[model samples]
Target: MRTRLMEAGLHDGATWRISPTPFLLTSADLSAIQSLGQHLLRFTHALNRLYYESVRGAQPTWVADYLDQGKPPDLIAYARMNRFRTALPGVIRPDLILTEDGFMISELDSVPGGIGLTGCMGQAYTDLGWPIIGGRDGMVAGFARMIRSLHESREGAHSPVASAEQRVPAPLPNPPQPSAARLAIVVSEESKDYRSEMLWLAARLREAGLPAQTVSPDDVIFTEEALFLAGSTPLTALYRFFELFDLKNIPKSELIMYAVKKGHLALTPPMKPWLEEKMAFALVHHPALEPFWTHELGADTFELLHRLMPKTWILDPRPVPPHAVIPGLTVDGHSVSDWKVLASLGQKGRRFVIKPSGFSELAWGSRGVSVGHDLPQTEWAAALEAALASFHQVPRILQEFRKGRHVAVSYHDPVTDEIVPMPGRVRLSPYYFIAGEVGTEGASAGPPSAKSVELAGILATVCPLDKKLIHGMTEAVMAPCTLA
Candidate 1:
């Protein structure tokens, strides 16, 4: 006898977010969130194959010279193309932090944005039957099989399209053909307030006939081949809701970046700003790359992401040899020689967060962060001298915060309308979709091919245990994560 996620509709008329009434999880926390979404999808394919084996010197040439310090060499050689090397990331979210030593993870997005509010709260709690966890249209069939595995990796990476009538009006889990070109989710002008949950996910893929919409980047146009909108129609799979540092205020973003660098536009999370970093979890706690991440992500997915990742650093300001210090921190016991000595401690000796390790607009939502016991010591030493004067351009990372863990939930009060229990502090997230394959072997994420990774919906949030900057949906207690 329960259902208060806005009476089972889960809100957002005009941002009336986070309330609660659907935060269960327990079939062993839903099989450890589907085995932590297949070990964080093999840790993003072993951090994109050990950052291309440190861009081929076979690992550790200062790991692709500190992730190509402030990147740009032709977008790091178009994210090391070997025709987009086993191209991953059709969708995969991971911000997790329930703590008390459980799901810490802290960041890994791949252009994430709550896909149509997790397929409209998993079809409103599985149409009231409620077993929800990637069933009940597994977040719209794992985002329609990751957009039909991006039209099976652009026509003939081993054909998969040419069915379901050149795409969209599918049979069940969307057929998605690019040959006729249609899908579009553009949204730029720096992610225009996530254009109302992508116009309610392009009105549920136009009520299943597909021909989805939700455009922006000035309603895209530039046609010499494709990318149309009010200018025509074309557009065969865009989905990028802008954030490779907002590609210079996107509008004629170089005509959809020279139409996906001349393949005639297909762009997924493929503009790879080093796969959107939080300093790739401080290069997975670099200590001279633990055996190239235990032989490129195995060894039980690098010891289960080195215990759900947390201890990170990457804040290089250079010049400091007064007999070295910073390795895995020491601070008050002496050993930190300048990050303005970790903003001259004090505030409970600052715990640490210090963000921005993405393309920049202060690195996607949560803007240039910098928590450290919630700022003060001269604004945490002016955010550590603007992350050490934008090290050659922009880079920052410090992590080691790990707090979130309160958990209760029952809000509905907008002026005592009733049902309010309030207790907060979650963050969960868990999305993992990935299917854009190239991993050959009769590869499939498209037609009759699936499970390269699935668990499509989780989100959660909660926040408020004396809030330390959680995120959107105001006061927090959001939902859609059931089982218990």
Candidate 2:
């Protein structure tokens, strides 16, 4: 397996600890995780609607204002257009921290990496006779299905729903043949690290008889009529691997957006900058938006999300009025009026996390993240002040930190050639694909399709116990989640 990963160039030039086996999950854990995808999909839909309604005066205007901050006016207007307003991300991956009781969703990634890496890991483990969560080729098949569904929807065809048992990797249904439609997974230079893995994925899709390929933004052939990888190979849909903030640097970004805006092509994730914000989590926990979320997500889902989502707040710099205090936030049983009070608290009192909200280079990959308890008093205060100061240009969010439960994992020591036990905390990233047809007119306001959210694969990153922030690093043990 180590040789296969290295040869495939899926490690992104970084070597990680090799686990002897897949991370095992209990049956109960499997049940709870399988149901989480649909709820998240619903949340995305509701968030889209809330923003549009806020713009139209049906809801609070501040909701839209908050999301529109720090974003370019032209791009915001393009996202709010009627042609693409019904669109949502075709793929969703939530960062879940495994606790003693359950898991908490730290954040969601729309244009997430690790899809190809996780798919390769799943196939490798399944080949070893492990009962992987999404079967042998679930990730590849799920991704193909999503692209095919988008293509079919654009061609005015109804997408066939898959059975619960058939959610795993399976043969594509034969109703609306999408063999002729090509898919281009466009990776920008900023995202060159995962380019090799995406190339591997495109090859697998081609092997499955789907016309898919990975290309850089420069390789895309743009004409007034449509987009193509070359003059002859016309693309039906595109999977954007780059973030919206980096569009200025990406080659032919305007051409690609023009193609989608003119109805010449379809793009997954819809280029909506607001949908990519981490502040959406903070919006979910807002008291003023409780009725909106509960109405859209229903009582049961609302309750479930409340339990699973950590309390979060957007670091707004404006001073609080003397007559009022921040909602749902208090220190020492007193409603706090200012943000600096928390910075002055001791380590035990400041169990929180500060990070960029979104639309910035530091938003992803744990780049500008600071854990309050892990830092000194002076450093924590600086982090808080900096976060508040950057509100207008690059927003930041403060979240209640929930520590992961300690677990024992065994890995093969390359030098010693012996199994070694390591104590660590786990972060599970389950890739969910929205495979159902996305309607153009009423899809955003309608209920979520039961079969749309398909759980393809789960990647577990077990960091050493000493590491407070869990991410893909050289010291972490990377493996796929599986049943015992």
Candidate 1, 1-484: lDDT as tens digits: 2243334233544244445357776676567768777677666767777777777777777766776787768767766666566556677788777766566778888888877776777676677777666665566556656665565446544345445334322333343322343677888766766677787777666655566678787778776776778845676677788876657667777777677666665667676566677777777777777777787666887777877788888888887788876667777677676667677788888888888777777776677787878877898888888887887688788887878767787766656568778777778787877664433211222221334677777868776788786766567666678777
Point out where model 2 deviates above 4 Å: 12-14, 157-178, 439-446
Clashing pairs in 2: none
lDDT of 2 by residue, 404-437 (tens): 9998898888877899999999999999988665
**Model-by-model lDDT, in order?**
0.68, 0.85
Which candidate gets the maximum TM-score versus the true structure? 2
TM-score per model over all chains: 0.35, 0.94
Q: Following a full C-alpha superposition, what root-mean-square deviation does model 1 have from the true structure?
A: 18.7
